[model samples]
Target: MPVIAVLVLDGVPGHQLTAPGLAFGTAARHHPPVAYDVRICTAPGFEATGGLASFRVETPWGLDGLADLDDTDTVLLPGHERFRDPPPPDVVAALRAAAARGCRIGAVGTGTFTLAATGLLDGRRAATSRRNTAELARLHPRIDVDPEGSVVADGPFHSAAGVLGGIDLCLDLITLDHGMAVAIETERQLFLQLHDPTTPATTCAAYTPPGSSLAPTTTWMEANLRHPLTLDDIAAHAGLGARHLTRRFHAETGLTPLQYLLRARIQRAQWLLERTEDPVERIAALTGLGTPANLRRHFQRQTGTTPTTYRTAFRTFVTNLTPRE
Candidate 1:
């Protein structure tokens, strides 16, 4: 069983605390036995409160309760407002010790601010709410704060943007460590959509058309995922040289044009795999990925499952659903 310690702070978002709890909390139900033990730890004088209704929560343990931080495999820091100020000396020491012992550390929203203050995020890829990006960057210039993605996982540390992104981060962890079936079931139990990290619009405003020469080229590739087009063709269609297109493409999307095109095609394949009854080879063809074997490789690489396994699980999920038919 994976033991998860969710470090709670006053004013922590209730949903952020509950998201990972619900996902990992239900692990036992997944394999017919519980696979995780989750605990909420707080500092002394800890009085947790949240919700529009505003309720107070009581915990039995204090920071000393996390004396076992060294033994914990994963530590979760949920969204909290007070993370701007460095954590108390004792808390910082505990966090530093946990990392030195090689525990996977995770932070959600401004909770990242707390983790950053521990000096553990230096040279690490991390993320926080857009509202706090400037502050995080200004405060910890050594930490790479990714403003675009909801979550950034650099080796042993993972950080997320906000409350909802917290859920996505947990799901990603479950999917990575356990399996996609566990992740999907957890999402179903929590009444949250199964998130795809590449679908940026769900958690972020769509990046506007930057009016670069690569703009129309990307737009065309997004629409033409079913067809194979060479990079030279894309450059010509965009009315730019290949070198110029590559430069502008990377600037606007933070991905080389080829990389962006591959991501778009893979996302399309995931959509079809989840929503349609198409055969794997057919889905591959439609997504411009060419072969079922190739599609399976990429699907597992991106989402931790093969096409057949995903479809089988999806079929089981549909069977369990109440039929509108």
Candidate 2:
């Protein structure tokens, strides 16, 4: 069994910490028994800091209570908002010690900042959220950071971009150490769709913060994925002109209207494939991807697997074991 230590820093992004906890924690609940032993470790005397919401939280054990590097096989770091500021020397030292002891170090989103601060990322290829790319490069010139891809592993150091990408990275890690089938099953159990690194910015850029002006439009796109929507139609729904809609969509969500629509359709296709035993053509029609050939082409381009292969390999292994009745 691999004991995994998740280092949650002060002022960490609440969602970042919770993302891995949900993915890996759910994975640890597998029926055949999971190989991971995960724990959340905070810095000594660490009081919960304000994150996404106005709330305070406290964990049971602090840093001292964390399993030593000698005992653990993997150490995970979730992102913190304070990436420019240096971590405490003791915190950096502990991580370095873990890395030196050959424990795999994993960082999600801006947590790579902490790793870079410790010099662990020197000469290493890693990844961080696309929005943080320029600053990350400026702060740590030695590390090779890929803003496009989801996960990158340099030696034993693994990293991922975005909150969702962390799930993909963890699954990839488990798959590499375990097996493909186990990873696929984990994804099934978690209801996680494997992110397509090849899709460029459609899904990633389509994401918008809540309360943003474009959120309503994004929601509308999501709801209408199965419908053939033109840019004029989308603009009309949002009560805006095509040009204004395009600009606003780009500014708020970092994606154009068409890209967002395609991603929504692709995401829907993925869900239908995973959850239903419907034929590929039916899934395609439901997701607005049209014919089975079109569905297979797009699905394969995004997921590196054909629709039939993905459904056969993933849908069968998931529990909850209900046939389409």
Candidate 3:
């Protein structure tokens, strides 16, 4: 089993600590076992303060538990109320040691500040809550802050933009560990939905007319990304005319029906490429791209890289995290 160490600190928000356990633990409950051994560790005398008024938390493991970096595959840092303050030296040291030992590091919300403090994020792309993006950029100009991305990954470091973005990041890690199928199953079991990070927000008052929502149709499309879908087919599914579907889809999702379908297919292809050892041709067939050449052309157009190159980089990162037996 892969070991995931969640490094806790004083003032850590309650949800941030619990989100990882819920995500990874739920995956472990799935058939065939996407197993992870997750533990919470903190410095001696450390206590976590919840964002709510009535809660405080204590973990069983201390800083000593983190000393053996070889036993850890990933370290997740959760944001605290005082994220602007420098992290404890002992905590910073352990994080650096874990990175040096080839463990992937992830930060949630203002926790990006904690990871940023270690200097490991220098020259790397990262994301944090939109409210704190300016401060993060000002404090660490060497680190590239992606204000628009919900999740940003640079080499071994990953950062998420908001409180809920942590759940997305964890699900993404689960996808990396097992496969898209496993992650999808886990999402269903957890009653969670995974949103495409690149999709523009549809909730803006200007875009969403009162009482009008494309959610039902979009949800259907997400569940059926493997099919070769056409505009008419989508229109019928949504109980609208083709022209009406195009207008509503563009207005709601900021993408035309075909554009949305293309992005959905590419997203599916990316998931398969990152998590499965399937060949490009097989992935193409699975994602409804028809053939390897078609998948390559579309993938390069969207991502500016070949599917093979993306797979190699993702697999290399995964391999480096797995300790030799």
lDDT computed for candidate 1: 0.71
RMSD to native for every prediction?
15.1, 18.9, 17.0
Which run of 10 residues does model 1 get worst, by summed lDDT? 199-208
Which candidate leads in lDDT? 3
Model 2: residues with Cα > 4 Å off, grouped in runs = 192-325
Question: On residues 1-325, what C-alpha lDDT tens digit does candidate 2 reach at each position?
Answer: 6777878777776665666666677666652345566777887534564455734556665665344656348888887657677888888888888888888888888888888999989998889887887788888889888967468988989998854537778887777765443465566556533463322211221345445787677777777777788999999989999999999888765678887787667767766776777888788888788888988787777656777776665544443232121
lDDT of each: 0.71, 0.71, 0.74
List, residue by residue over 151-184, the lDDT tens digit for candidate 3.
Answer: 8889889888755537778988877776554565
lDDT of 1 at 138: 94
Encode model 1's per-residue lDDT on 1-325: one tens digit a residue: 5667888877787777777777677545544433777778885445765546555676665665566655447888886657787687877887888788888889988889989999999988899876788789999999988976477899899987764538778877876765554465555444423464322111111121324455556667877988887888788888888899888877776677777777777767755766788899899999888998888777777656677666566556545542221
Off by over 4 Å in 3: 192-325
Model 1 stretches with alpha carbons more than 4 Å out: 70-72, 163-165, 192-325
Q: How many angstroms is residue 268 displaced in model 3 relative to the true structure, after the best TM-score fit?
A: 8.5
